[model samples]
Target: MKKLVISLALCATNSLFAQQNWLGNTSPTYEELIAHLQQLDRSHKEVKLYNMGPSDYGQPIYLCVVNGHRDSSETFEKARQSTTILINNAIHPGEPDGINACLIWLDQWIRAGKPLKSHDGGDLPVIAFIPAYNVGGMYNRSSTSRANQNGPEEYGFRGSTKNLDLNRDFTKMDAVNTYTFVKIFQALDPDIFIDNHVSNGADYPYTLTYISSMKERLAPSMQALTYAHCIPTIKDYCQIGNFELFPYVELKGETPEEGIVAFNDLPRYAMGYASLFHSLSFTVETHMLKPFPERVKATLQFMNATIAYAIGNAERIEIARKEAIQWSQAQTYFRFNYQMNEQVKDSIRFKGYKAVYPIHPITGLAQLEYDRKQPYEKYIPYYHFYISQDSIAVPKYYIVGGQETKVIASLKANGVEFQTLDSFETKTVTCQFVKSYKAPTRPYEGHFKLSEIEIASSEQAILLKPGDILIPAQQERAYFIHAVLQAKAEDSYFTWNFFDSYLQQKEYFSAYVFKAQIEDLLSKNPELKKSYEEKKALDIKFAQSEWDQLFYIYQRSPYFEQTFMRLPVYELND
Candidate 1:
C-alpha cells in the first residue's frame, strides 16, 4: 500500500510537470501566462517578475528576469551592468511561439536546477523576456485572425485594443505599450535583444528564419560582431539541435524561385529600435505553415543558442557594444535613407517549394500556391547589400520647440539626455523648411504617413522659450537622436506624421485680400520686384494669372507666416 501511494504521487507530479511544460500546439492566454510566471517566481529564487508599466489595455505589462541578482532591484541593476539577453514576445500575439518557448525554457531551466553557467562553463548572461507584450491583443483572442498560420488552437490578434500595430509604434510611440516597452528597454539596457515573430509569405521548408539589423545602419564593431560571429555561431548551434535556420524570406519577386532580399529594419521596428542603442538585435520569424509546436521548439532552440552565444562571448559582446556606443558618440556624419543595391547580389542555398498556379475548383480562377511535393534546393540570389542615399553632418545640439510635447515625451522615453530651458533665449540655429512631401490617401496604423519628404535648411536666429529641449548629439543614443530628428530619415518624426501640423498653412490670406498688398510689398523690395518681373516674362502661367502673381508676391513678402511649413526641430552645428 505504501509503495503504491508513493508511485501514485510520482505519477501525479510528472503529469503536473507535463502540463506546465508547453508540449502541444497551444499558447497560454494573457492571464494564464502571467499566472504561470507568477507561480515560477514564487517557487524559484532565480526567477523574478516585475510589473514594469501599463499596456494599452490598462493591464500591467510584466518583465520576467532569469539568472539575475537576489532581488528585483538588484536583478535590474545587474542586467544593466552585465551582459544580458532580452527576448520580447507577443508584440504580434498571433505569433505566440515565443511565449511558449519562454515558458518551456523556464521549465527546462528549473528542471536542470537552474544552471547559472553555460555548457562551456562560462557565466550565463541575465536572461529576460516579456511574456506577452500586446496585452490588449492578448485579450482579443481568436483562432481565425491568422488565417494562414497552422495550429495555435487559439491566440491573440495582431493589433492592440486601439487597433494599432504595436510593431510600428516604436519610434512614434503612439501606443501606451510603446512607452512601457521603452521603459523596460531603457531599464535593462540589454546587450542583446530578440523580438520573436512568425512569417507570412511564400512556402518554405525551413521552420525558422531570422532578421538581423541592416548591416549598413549598424556601427562597425556591432556589424562585425553580429555578422562575423553571433549569427554564424547561432546557426551552428541551431544545426546541432536538428533544425535549419535561414534569413527571413523578404522576396525580391512574388515567388521564392525569383529571389530573396534582406529586410530593411527601420526605426519603427522593435529590433531596429534596439539596434540604434547598440544592442545586438534580431527578429526571429518562424514559418507560418509549420506546426505551432514545431515552431515553438525552434524558437526555444534559438533562445538557447542566443543565450549560449551570449555566455561564451560575453566579454567580446560587451567590448563591441562599448566600442559601438563610443563610435556613435564620436561620429561626425550620420548616414541614413538606405537603399538596397540591386546590382550587387550574393547567392545563398535556399530550400523552397515550387510555386504553382492552379485553378481553384470553387472559384475557377488560377491562384498562386506552393506545391509541397516539389521541394527543391538551389542557389538563389540574395540581395543583401545596401547603400546610404543620404548623409547629414552631425550637429552639436538639437533644439526641439516647447510646443512639441509628444516628440519630447518620445525622446525622453528612449532615455535621450537633454537640457530643458528655464528662461527664454535666442540663438542662431539651422532650421528646416518643408520643401515638398506627399501624404498617403488612406490611414495606415492610424496615421496618414508622410513620405517622399524634401527639406530645405537655412540658418536663422530662433527664439527659444522655457521648456524647449536642447539635446546633445554626442551621446550613447546619438544614432536614435539622428534617426528621428533628421527630417528626411525613413522613419523620422516627419515621416510618421508627427509634424503634420507644421506642413499645413495655418494662416492663409484670401487672393482678393492679399492682392491689395502685393504692389506695396514688392515695391519695398527691389529684388522681389525684379524676380516678379522675370517670372512674368519667363513663365506664361505667372504672366497670365493675376491671382498667381499677387499670391507669389504675398508668399515672398513678410506678411506670410514664417513658421508655416517650418519644422520645430532646429540644429546647432559644431
Candidate 2:
C-alpha cells in the first residue's frame, strides 16, 4: 500500500503540472513558474528551456525555445536557417502580469497542441522565449511579502530599487553578463521578436506601441492581423504610438528615437538586430498601473493575438517581410522616416529625416553632418547614438552603473554637456500637471509625480515613505542638457558625417553626389535624383557583402535545400 501510494502521488504531481495553470487567476511565484516549465518540458521535447544566465540579484532567468519546423525541431541542420522569436516579460517584478501571460501562451502552444491546420498543415515557426527578461528585477524580494510588484508605486516595495531599466539597455548592450546570453541569441538569426512590458499609472494606457522605426506604409500592414484578434479588453485599451508618446508626435519634423530601431531600444535592439541581419520583429507594451487583472488580460490577449496573427498570416507576412528587404535595398534617406507637416505658418522648414544613418555596430560611431534642412528644430544639428535604442549617453548624464564617464566626456569634447542630478540632492523640481479635456478624458490620476520621503534602503519596508513623489529614484531624462549649438560648415565634423551618411544612406545618394552637392551641383533636394551609375559598382559590393553573410549561414543547415529555393531568386539579375 505504501509503495502504490508514493507511485500514484508521483503521477498525480506530473499530471497536475500538465494542466493549464498558467493563465489562471491564481498566480505562481518564480520558483513555481520555473518548476511548472520544467515539468512541461518533459512532455514536450520540442520546447527547450535555458537560463540566459543569472541576474545580479541571484535569480536564474528562464528562457524557453520552441522550434518552428517539425522536421528540424530536434537535430541541428547543416545550415541553421531558423527564425527565432524572442519574447520576454516582467522587467519590473511588480509587473508580473506579462510573465504570467507569457506562461499562458507557452501552455497554449506547447500543451494544448494547437493544430497547424491554419498553416495548411505546415510546420509552425520556432520561438526563443525570454519570458522574464528582467528576472532579477522582477524576482527580487519586495518590502511586502507579495509575489510580484504592485503600484501606487510609492506604495509598492523597493519602489525605486530597480533603477536599472532593462528597456534602456537595448542599444547600449553594455551589460556584460547579459552579453553572454545575447551572443548566443545573435548566433541564431531570429525572424520575428517582441519584448513585453507593463505601463505604470492611472490611465492604464491600453494601446500596443510598435517601434515606429519601421517604414510608415509597411508598419500598419505588417501589424494588421495582430490588431484583429486581440481580446476586447486589450483591443479596447489599445493606443497606437509607434516611436514615442509626446515629443515625436506633437513636434512636426522631429525625428525622435522612440522605436526599437534606434541605437538600442531594448525591443529595438533585439528586433533591429533581427531586421538588420534580415528578419521581422516586434516590441510589446502593456499598461501596468491599472488593476492587476486588467493588465494580465490585455497582455495575454496581445500575446495570443500576435501568435495567431503570425500563424494565420505566416505566408503573407513572410512575403511582406521579404518585400521590406527589397525596399531597403533601393532606398535613399535610409536612416529616418520623414513625415511632412503642413500646419506650418509660412516657409516650409526642414524637418528631421524619418530615419538616420545606420550604426556601424562595432565602432559605435554615428558622426553625421548637421543638416540645416532637417525639419524638426530640436532634432537639427545634432546626431544621435544609443547604447542600446532607448538609452542615451548614460555616462554623461548620471552614473546609472559601470564606467560611462568616458562616453560622456567624448560627447562633451564634441560639445554635448549633460548632467545627472539625484532628486534628493538637487532641489530643482519640474513636475508639471497638464489638464486634458479630450473626449476620452481618462480621469487623470497623476503618475510621474516624485515626492521626497525618508526611508532606510532595507528590503523590509515598502521602497518609499508617505508623501514621496515618483520622480526619478535617480532615473533621469532631460533633453535640453546644453545651450544652443551653432556652427559653420567648414569647421564642423558634423557636416562631413552628415553628408557621408546622407550619400551612403540613400540607394541613389552616391559618392559623386556626396562631394558635388557641397561644390558643383545645386540640388540639395532629395527628390530630383532618379539613379546614379557612378556609385553603382560600390553599391553592388556593399549589397553583395550582406547577401554573402546570409547565404553562408543558410549553406550550413538542413535548410541548404532552401538555398535552391532562395538562391535562384537572385536580386543580382536586376
Candidate 3:
C-alpha cells in the first residue's frame, strides 16, 4: 500500500517535469497567452486572432480561428460547410498543462511563413483555440507555476470580489471582460468545442482525458471516439483517462445501488451549453496533478486527436457544429445576446440537487459539481442525452433572487436591462424551446420533441414534463436515502418551481430522490401501490401532475406557455 502511494507520487512529479518542458514549461500570464497567440498569427497566415471579449480581469480573451478561408456571416450559420474544433485552456488557472499543449498545437499547425495548404489532404479542419479560459485566474499566482506569468501569481487570487470559482460561475453570467472570448462563440458558432483544463493531480493515473455528455447524434463513443479517431496520437505519450465503469459497458444514469451519475466535468459543461442549445461540445481534462510534463504531453495528445475527431467525423461533425452556431444565432433562449448558464450537480457529494433558485428579490445560487469518480477497469458506457435546437425564448431577463446579484452584474455588464415587474409589469419573460418529454411510470426511456417554452412564476415555477421529479419542499438530509430509486435518461426536463440560470447536472440527483419517494410511498400504501402497480394507467396522472404544477407557475408568473402538456386545469366535480 505504501509503495503504491510512493509510486503515484513519483509518477506525478515526473509528469509535471515533462509538462514544464513542453511549451517551455513557463507559466504565462494573460498577456503571455495573447503574445504567444499573436506570435502564432504573425508567423502563420492560416491562423487569425479574433478577440472574443474581455474577461473578468479586463484582459482580452482571444479566439484564435485558424483556417485558410475567411468565415463570412452567411457561411457562419451553415454548419454543413464549416467543421470547427473549439479548444479552450486554463479555465482553472492553476492547471497549466493544457495551455502548453495548445501553444504547441498552434505552432505545428499554421507552419508560420511557409504555410502553403491546409492539414487534411488539402481541406484542413478549421480550429478555434481560446488558450486561456479564466484570464482572471490565469493572471493570478500558482503555487505550482514554477515560473510566474501574471505579476508573480501573487496578485492573481485574493478570492474576494473575485470569490468565483470560474467553473462554478458559469451559471451566473458575468459582464466582466473575461466574457469577451465567449461573445464570438455566440456570434460565429463552431462545430465541435473542446474546453480544456488540468486535473487536480496524478494521485490517480486515470485522472485525465474527459469526454462531455452530448446529444445522441454526435458520437458513437465520446471517449472511445476520442481514443479511436482523435486522441490516440497522445494516449501512450500522455496518460489519459477514459469514461468507463467498473463492469458494465453500457452508459446509465444510476447504478444498482442508485446514486448521482456524473459525466465529464469542465469540458462537459463548456460544451454542454453548446450541445443543449445546439452545438456539439466536449471538455478535455489533463491531469495537472501529474508531473507538468506529463500533463502537457497528454494535452498535446488531446489537441491532435481532437482535430482528427472533427476530421474523422467530418460529415456528422459539420451537421452538429453548424446546427449549434445557427441554433445559437437563432435560438429562442440563447438569441438575446444575453449569456445563459446552468447549475452542475452531484448526487453522492451533493444529493437532491434542485433548480430551486427563485427569481427576483431572493437570489440563491444554483450549485454544481464536476469530476466525480471514474469507474475502475470495468467501465460502463454513458447513455447520451438529447440536445435540441427547438428555441425557447425569454423577452426580459429577471433576476431570480438577490443571490443573483452577480447575475445582475453580469446581465448589466452584457448590456441587458432587467426590470422587476409588479404583477402588472410581469408582462415580459424569457422564452425557450423545451423539448417535449413523456416517461413511463415503470422504468423507461422518455420521449419528447424540443419545443419552444417560456418561464416565470408567482404561484408555481415554469414546468417541463420532469423526467425524474424530486418532490417534497424539505428533506431528511440530502442524499441519505439508501436504495434510492431513479428515472432513466429519457426522463430529463423535470418539474421545477423556480429558476436560476440552468444547471446541467446528472439529473440523477432529482431522479433518485423522486424515484425513491415514489417507490417508497407505493410500497407503504397498498391501494396506491396497487394502482401504481399498473404503471401505464398511473403514468398519465404522474405526468399531468407535473405539467399542471408548471402550468400554475407559468400562469402566475409573467411567462406564458410555449408548448402543450397534459396539465390539470380544473375539476368538474369541484
* Candidate achieving the largest TM-score: 1
List model 2 lDDT by residue over 2-26, tens digit each.
Answer: 9979865774565445334543444
Q: What is the TM-score of candidate 1?
A: 0.96
Decide which is better by TM-score, 1 or 3.
1
Query: Can you tell me which runs of candidate 2 are displaced by over 4 Å?
Result: 1-29, 53-61, 67-84, 110-122, 143-163, 201-279, 326-574
Ranking by lDDT: 1, 3, 2
lDDT of candidate 3 over 436-460, digit per residue (tens): 3332344211112121233332233
Q: Candidate 3 at 40: error in angstroms?
A: 3.1
The 10 consecutive residues of candidate 3 with the worst lDDT sum are 479-488
TM-score of candidate 3 against the unseen true structure: 0.49
Candidate number with greatest lDDT? 1
lDDT string for model 1 (233-269, tens) is 9999988988888999999999977889999999999
Compute each candidate's TM-score over C-alphas: 0.96, 0.46, 0.49
